[model samples]
Target chain A: MCKNALTEEKFRELDSYVDTLPEKHGMLISVLHRAQGIFGYLPKEVQLHVARSLNLTAAKVYGVVSFYSYFTEEPRGDHIINVCTGTACFVRGAEGILKELENHLGIKSGQTTPDGRFTIDALRCVGACGLAPVIMVDGKVYGRVKTGEVTGIVKEYAEV
Target chain B: MSAYRMHLLVCGGTGCRASESKLLAENLQALVMTAGMGREVQVVITGCFGFCEKGPIVKVLPDNVFYVEVKPSDAEEIVSEHVLKGRPVDRLLYVEPEQKGKVSSHGEMPFYKKQLRIALRNCGFINPEDIEEYISVDGYQALGKVLTEMTPEALVTLMKKSGLRGRGGGGFPTGLKWEAAARNRADVKYIICNADEGDPGAFMDRSILEGDPHSVLESMAIAGYATGARFGYIYIRAEYPLAVHRLEIAIAQAQQMGLLGERIFGTGFSFDIAIKFGAGAFVCGEETALIHSIEGERGEPTNKPPFPAESGLWGKPTCVNNVETFANVPPIILKGAEWFASIGSEKSKGTKVFALAGKINNVGLVEVPMGIRLREIIFDIGGGIRDGKKFKSVQTGGPSGGCIPASALDTPMDYENLTCIGSMMGSGGMIVLDEDDCMVNVAKFYLEFTCDESCGKCTPCRVGNKRLHEALTRITEGKGTMADLDNLKELGAIIKDTALCGLGQTSPNPVLSTMKYFWDEYLAHVVDKKCPAGVCTALLSYYILPGKCIGCTACKRVCPASCISGEVKKVHEIDQARCIKCGACLKACKFGAISKK
Candidate 1:
């Protein structure tokens, strides 16, 4: 878990979104997504809230959220860096990029920076095999990224 | 909203993105604005047009003119001639070889004519995130019908009558599973959506979840209603964040719309979905293993027949259906079973969504009728092989599927047709292999995947697969004897016959398929000590032709193994003992100096 947990404002923001949703039987997932978007991590209290709101058990809600990798319970940094490590990317030196990113950020994939500026993660496929060595910072995709480019990319985010 | 103008639907699939589709869109936009009919023209960036070889695709609506291979430079001409002057861009249009001088609309493009698009209905049309858009297109109406009017039994009967089978492998009847769980004597029943698609190159479920997530949610709720289950769980792999995110949003929207939740449409029936993530394990796709993972175990398949329908998920009766199977439910209920039953073959009902990948041109998501011929999909729909490469074989059903050689291209794709030809439709992953791909190497690739992803619960999968991989590794390295091939076949059969679960049972498919279809490649490796496709490092040697050498020293400079010894302006010689065959020399050579033999 990142040190910077969900602030009260973020919780309120998520609550507001949840309040507007119709009380559907399958709304637990939607609630968790909203919580993750606002809080960066889904805290236990929010999970309970989601369960209560959707008329589900907290265990059930936790089970669903915990089942997928996209739902995180730890605060992420300002930038989320996802490196594609699928078959094509792996064959095209994506592992080298991951190693370089780890060295530069001093954190492994799935961990947020201590100062909370970047969260690095490895993905199976971003569905962009034509651009084998691909990385996405935020929603912008940078293709054919090399190990040499890792320093400049991380520095740009860290300095921000 | 001026009715006098046209609509240009551009394919924005990932493949098109690679072909600078974004640039095409930009140029189209600029051209539309400059024509002073911007208000009349609607340039919509739609998801995958499916005709990928001739992409980035531009489709003109109202008239429905299809344009293929639209580059950025051609954008101005398309806008100026097609949109502005109402003249077709003849040069940019897809010229069908059979059609001769005639170009066709998207529907007339043979790839889509034979196909049905039930699972992919909303994919290329709707903005995936906007609930209102989905609603306008009759998204939650099925939920409304089920909640307000239909009884659980009625819904299940509709599904059974529709003859819908699970699209995510096994081909089990969807309604039967629900009915079994409904009949089971359990206080707390559950519905599980198996979105933990672990098949290599399979993305049909993920793409559906990404493009039209609400359908899956609606289907799960429908399943919940039919089975009398209060809770639903979608066990999607952690690998698909986009699917996960979209699924979450769709659930929220459905809740907001009163389609889900307690007293849905004033009915006492209620079912809510929660997501469970599988942490990079392929075997967890099995129902028992998935249940164990949801129970926070290490995701190893357990003994069956107390089958999930009878006992599952904390020891309650649970019904598990794949994402594609659930996706077929609402439509069956809405359109009636006979409508779906009428579309597909006698045994298999409705459409199957295949992740059309590998050496084909239009590598994207495709939903075809169950009986559509492989030739139709690969040649007609996929735009043939890229750059006119001769097709070798098409590998269906991921690692578990067999390779169908070019001779079998005319075979129809259904549960029976695939299984009859030494392959099973495990999940819809169709990888087209070209002539350049070595059969031995292809088998080696699938074997390697199974080895790493095997759960190691059973000796057959864990150990037998390791042995098969070693033989393939040996064969690919040009060191295997004829005895090794015999050993490979024996071990593969053993794993298939004795393994406890589906993972082990189907682990031998790649080797079996390649051996069946590309035995010559294997013979070449063993008998001739050569890799036919120049893929195996041990059978290949990098040589510099004295005539082609420009004395660039690029190969010598980049050799990580330090085996290439050469001076400037001179031919280079590789020390084969030190060369690890990483192919750095092949990539670094500028003057075609390096050739592999």
Candidate 2:
């Protein structure tokens, strides 16, 4: 579903990288991680290329990718706002925060906004429950976030 | 080295860092430099202090005086008043909840009084990135002692003599697990650090790895020498980027220093470690599932007749241990078995670290000796319930654990006692609940997690948990009858009894525990069709208290549904039929007129 298949530049990089790893048994996961890193999200085209390079079935690669929540099958937005719905956050009004985000972004948790600016994802507890009602944009964390502050935070990111 | 008489150690843990401890660190350093006492005063940024409610904590050295809720603005006052004039910033000092006085030292504070840090010994004390800081605190001496002097059998005996159980939920004896792996003679055996902690509120493992990674690496090498294994894999969650980043630096530094990879301490034994990323599967926390994950499979658990110790990781013997478990190893070796054994209760040994959160004043990581009562943890260490609310229940062990009622407040927190009360001491995620929290909703929250994370290989966990979630959903949505409660009870018991893996077996804990302790709440949901805590949206009804309504049209303006219609300065009324019960109007009402009934 990508624009073409893989570009010549991307193909050469991937092919050489696969040669460096063991193709026998345990290198599929490593290759998949690298592939996902190279192409922001793992589309079917990339998965197929990985299968061919590693000499594994596309079904095998797809099975592993679909099993984990980290790998995505589609393209994501520039910024993914992960609001922690972990037990502590949930108790500390995380749902309200999520609802506010959904309204402001004009999309649900899984869907990327039409402009491809932001995507909302609810993650399980991130072990920072001490900062309950926690949200992370990209990798930076915003703690003790209140419902009132949601609009200002989103406005700041909207320009970016 | 500069002669620094006073050392101000600040909390650099994730929780404190989020609250601007970095700014506080920078500010303190700036103020100290400006005062021309830079050499005489050292401002060091360390890991968590476990008193997170009162963070950006700055603990002064030599006297052990702990300052809480330290701001960047307070740095100048602290330096000028305290460092220069020999007087503490009384406003920044932590106020004791019990006595309402100026408690100075860490020991006098209720939060740190009962805590004894062993696994977290180096955290909040030294810089985790520095190898020399770790070495100064007797870090790699355990690996050195084990490699040069003691035999494999002697070390296992010492581990067994000390009553150190695995801190990773199951309370499996660490010594016995190592001995089993050691018995099976395999040339390419592997040692695994189970850093894939999937519990929602838990972060002790992440904190240990982020704050003190070398301790785990040193202990892993010791494990390799003892078990006749040369390769080790740390199966860590990918979500913890900071911990992962720190671990990478630590491993490279250790390998460069000749602590890991090829003949550690110049002995004949050689060991190496590699990082294997876990891609968001909670079931991988199980050893069998973890092994499968490493092998690039679906991370599904199998029957344990071939237990990981006998056959694991490409069919070779493997030894699996949690991060906190390995962290305790070096100290155990340094201070002998008897010395470690004398710290805790009969069965559980060494101090246990808990990620204490929810409705508690001091929300942070705490480590206390085993057999300490919940009263000490909740009231003493946790500084009681937040906003002066009444304590309802405490959920231990995350999604796999059960809730202990307020009646069991004095219950000693150990593996056996928690199990006796229908909960297990799961990787130390102690979330305190207040009176405002609904027990039925709490049970639903955990069931939702288990249902989503069930490996789907087994029927009881995959389907049974889904059914249990549906039953709970019906109850929360005010669509359930009394008979559904029996259905939930029967289904939860069956899933607990017949599910395949440890994850499947414990999946129904939240439901079963709530059923046992909060049957009254469940009965109210079914019989009365009301949520006492006003949490369930389906059961909530908006009512404008006419007596309290001073009516500035505050609720009317923000109402998305436009249900609240009233004049400028009169009692406002909510149209019941048009109301969607989003609670936006309730939050907007400054006069406290809108209340959910």
Candidate 3:
């Protein structure tokens, strides 16, 4: 209830944004993007609110959410680390880099740290093949990342 | 119009931007101002130069001096030496890998020697955010020419004669697709630019959208005119923040300039474009799946024949084309179809943009003629394999494509030839592999991707691909029988025959192609339980060579599993049962005592 009260303003902001859209026929994906942007992750309450606002069933919204990998139901950490597992990176020793990060963070890919400080994800490709063996810490790309340098790179965010 | 004598074009592509080219641009601007050459010099941030191997690239006009690997600190030297004294910096010039000489001009570099730049002509040349820059390069002239001078039928005929096929993996003729859409009767229709770019190692589409977005938009409007569609949508990936930003600016600029909005050129034909963001679904790269995603569905594909050309996007006729496909349209409309068809091989006309990556010396986007040999692309244009290593194989296409071995290196690259070699040009992702890469493991990697990305709509894609992936996993884990190889072939053919969508049908390519070319690698894994490349950890064992051991404790000290047992000044031995195969000992061994087989 307290969480609800805290996020009431965010829901209102989302509602007003939905109202401003010219047509709502095929705006579910865009509206959900906006909702996720506001709420960090989509809980049942947010999905219900969106369903009610858009005159859609809750099952429909949940189905759409679960279908896309980008949408998450659970909350994430302060920083998200995405390791590039694309072919270009894979051939250039991306698996070793991923293993190093897992050892450093004490968490597997797609799992958040217990302290909620970092979450690591193995992304398919971010399309920066020029910089093979790439990783992104909160959307700031670091290219040609070596296995030994993984610990040092994570320390910058951990310390802050 | 301006009194600026020297123009500095800094690469602002995603690759260079990752290397902090933004800061480099700002630093160059500040230094130019400090040198009191603000009136004489101008610094402009342009899109990708495609020379991403040696970025951040800075090109100076008038002298045509190209600098590579430039840092922010180099800004002062550039403004002072190059801008003021008119002398080019020697240390920053790109040294040819073979010649070992400083190549100052971009034209002299071998990387740019055997290249064509129709789709990417304006990428490194102009600021993508400026409409004036695009207009100056004859960007929207195609749209004006189509709307005023030519009729819809003439445009369709011109496209048919051009012989341009889709650059998005499938070599479907673009002109024929437009003709089908034009034949359909509907009051409301749609034009979709497929910018999803779902290929794992491909970034050409993203580069075009980031570098010359107006070209795509103008072509989309032209497509709308040809197909009788007044509304358009660009289905793009949300992960591409920079491309999305540039597109928003390009659309707003075009609309403000009366080029995109209603009654463009004050003609009766009107067209408008809006962007729809994709939420990380690779299956959406398919036209039907892409349409469903735009309609806010689950991005799953349905059967075709009621193709989007007939019924699409709220039950309206729609024509969907890839970003590279649309980028090639304006040029075809401006230059006659025969002029465009004169280049490249028969059946597949014009050049193709390939994202050349992985194990290659030059890992960047390259646009070459259709009939160019794979040998030329890998050796001449790509500067050969990195570190002078022996060439093993190259994986063309993406997960849906196959690997071509060294024997097929001379095969001319085109839709027919690549398919004939058991590999399709899927979205033009050419990933070169060296001797260190394991063919069986590479096949397993792609199967894993397909199993994950499959929409799970049809059983062949959902369950059949899963079974194939399981067989691949077992082989890679050294727990396979020779019978598994036969099963993989049978199951792969079944999936290809019965799968509903393009993604599912082509999902078995990686396995089939690798089986066809690298059969010995698989036989070794199944019969001898040895991974020839030593990539599969389950098939590898580490040991210390008694001859090479200097009795050093380096390997023992760095062993994470504590499996290496030895004392100071004593030869070390690895406990086979306890060794985790992390390879830390091999890296830590200073005397080269540790080896894996």
Candidate 4:
């Protein structure tokens, strides 16, 4: 498929970057970060390529990938919605906002919509406690969000 | 140096940036240029002003007028009136909530009155991306002093005398950590700056990294010199894009200025630093786990005795320190240990930066001296509870910490005192909870966090925490008996005793402390099968009051389960058997007929 060729080019680019590193012993995490950036998510092939490039076992690569909450093996949607559920956010009624979003999207947290338009996830804290009950669509932060505003927020992203 | 007539300092912190402070800065700049006061006036986007409650804040120098909640449109008035005509904007000033008067200067504000600024000294003042701005404030002087004037042993001794404890909740003496690393002779020693601030409600570390990154960098270089390490790594969180970008710029600027990388000031000491990104793991805040994470391993903690100082980071002696702890280093080297020691209580020296959030009136960052009373932090500095709500408890130290009840408001906040009262001065996340928040739900919330974050390396942490979370869940769901309460206590104690790492050891603190203080609430949940705070939806039942019901059919139309029955203009009744307790009807009713209990 045409998509496979495009992905191969990305793989070559990742390989070139891995080759440029002076030391490869402790560069797996950094390489995986780059791989995820390029591919959007780390699939089996990408993880295998990273494992081969870093001289790490595929199991080792998978172990590191699965250990961190930041790394994901599955493909993500175009827009990722992260609702802050930290203590500050929780106390400030973030649960109501999250529930509203879950109902609006008809998908639970960590699951993408059927159309693959948005993926909702819960963040422990983005260190933006000053703006309690915060959410980030893609990377743009929306702070002090109310349950009534959840549908309007999703509509902006959905239209885009 | 061009001496500008006046300077406008804008808050460029994450909170303010979220509120479009950057656009406000650009607007101010454009206006300044248009007024031809570009040379006469300077608009600098500095780090967090600490008063994030009323951001985006813009402060005017020379006059020292502090303005809060500034919009991009307000930039025109600020430049036209404040900057051009030398007249301060009256409406934009921070008003004292209690006094009902506008406070002109930051010094006069109650939010900053009781606060001390040591770690956050250069945060709001200096331009973090510029090396010259950092140098202007005696920035690398400590590194220079340590490198040229003092020997390695003397630097270590001076640090030991400073009595600066680790601010990352361990409260370990910084000097002793350095001494251990210095004592262990290795060819390739390392200095790691732990910027993996994982506490949910805390952002002080990110603020420091974003606002005054050079402080942490300068301290790390000094730490390297003291420990005789040539290479260092700052393991920071990847989630903080602004902090990561600022640190990259700061490192490049520092390297170009000969402050970092290779021989500094033409000394034989050669040092360089690199950044390692953490991929969202809370356990990586632990030093040993952090070391493993840097080595590209699954960030799991190994046992102590072979500590990071003894054997770490490829089995070499490594000195790992927290961002806040390292930020305190440069000042201690510049000002002697006694001067720093005199500021706080005897054991806990210097100040602690706490991220005051949740139901507090003024939710922001405040660095107060140790031994300050909790009431001072909550009432005086924080402006008391938001919406005039009754303060129930304040959760400190994040998930690893416990809630302090209102009775302990007068208790002094130090390492020992906090530990004595079933809490630790964790990474300083002070989330104030009001009477509306349920204590049982709060305990469950922390337990859920710990259970999800547990690395599964130890049995007590992985299995025991899951069980504790289930017990807490049972209590919250009104399905718990008194025996479940006993099981929670017993399992919590066992987990504390048998857990391998600090993450597991202190995980049950929230549950235990809440049980100790709010046992009556828990009893009400288990015995009466009722949630006193009305937070547990499973324990709540909705009823329509006949006195207030207008029969508008609003509740009937909005009910997802179609459980509400009655015609229009007639009193509606919710079918008790079919009611899902979604509270949709309660929210939709216009007459305020619905009540939950």
The Cα local distance difference test for each model comes to 0.79, 0.89, 0.92, 0.92
> Candidate 2's residue-wise lDDT over B395-461, tens digit each?
9999999999999988877899999998989999988999889999999999999988998999999
Candidates arranged by DockQ, highest first: 4, 3, 2, 1
Instruction: Name the regions of candidate 2 deviating beyond 4 angstroms.
Output: A1-7, A22-24, B1-3, B27-41, B73-87, B550-578
- As a whole number from 0 to 100, the lDDT of residue B465 in candidate 2 is 94
The C-alpha TM-scores of every prediction are 0.77, 0.95, 0.98, 0.98
Sort order, TM-score high to low = 3, 4, 2, 1
Cα displacement (angstroms), candidate 2, residue B533, comes to: 1.3
lDDT of 1 by residue, B338-398 (tens): 8999987889988998876667666667788888899998887777886688888888887
Candidate 4: stretches off by over 4 Å: A1-6, B561-577
Best by DockQ: 4
- What's the C-alpha lDDT at position A108 in model 2? 97
**Could you tell me which residue pairs clash in candidate 3?**
none
Per lDDT, the best of the predicted structures is: 3
lDDT string for model 2 (A1-160, tens) is: 2432457777677778887775546887777777777777788888899888777899998999999988888778878899999888988889889999999888999889887888899999876787888998876788889988888887778878
Q: What is the lDDT, from 0 to 100, of the residue B354 in candidate 1?
A: 81
User: Which candidate, 2 or 4, has the higher lDDT?
Assistant: 4
Q: How would you encode candidate 3's per-residue C-alpha lDDT over B119-223 as one tens digit per residue?
A: 988898989999998998998999889888999999999999999999898889999999999999988999999999988999999999999999999999999
Pick the winner on DockQ between candidates 2 and 4: 4
Q: Per-residue alpha-carbon lDDT of model 4 for B419-491, expressed as tens digits?
A: 8899899999999999899999999999999988999999999999899999889989999999999998999
Superposed Cα deviation of residue B393, candidate 2 (Å): 0.6
Report the TM-score of candidate 1, chain B only. Answer: 0.86
